[model samples]
Target: MNNINSGWRSGILEKIQGRLMKVYLLARRFRKHIKDLKNIPRTPRCGLSKQETIINKH
Candidate 1:
């Protein structure tokens, strides 16, 4: 029957919408985490620079 077909279509659409919402939520969470990390200041690492040579002078 046409009504049965419509019901099936509606069900499929609902499942697709649910999946899309879950993906959107995950993307938003990832974006927020990335933004938080970006806001943190990173200190530059000096690998055996002049400061260490002077300090280690014998």
Candidate 2:
């Protein structure tokens, strides 16, 4: 029956929508984490040049 088909379709659509929402939430969280990392200042690479020269002599 058409009614049964519609009900089945609706159920599948709901499942798909639920998955999309979960992915969206996860993506949002991942983006926020990436932003937090970007905001952190990087430490200066002091003394690395001296170490590289010392290693290259071998």
Best prediction by lDDT: 2
Against the true structure, candidate 2 reaches a TM-score of 0.68
Separately for all candidates shown, the number of backbone clashes (residues 3 or more apart, or on different chains) is: 0, 0
- Looking at model 1, residue 1 earns an lDDT score of 100
TM-scores of all predicted structures: 0.66, 0.68
Per-residue CA lDDT of candidate 1, range 1-58, in tens? 9999999999999999999999999899777755645544452335334434543562
Model 2 alpha-carbon miss at residue 6, Å? 0.3
lDDT of 2 by residue, 2-42 (tens): 99999999999999999999999989977775564554445
- How many collisions between residues are there in candidate 1? 0
What are the clashing pairs of model 1? none
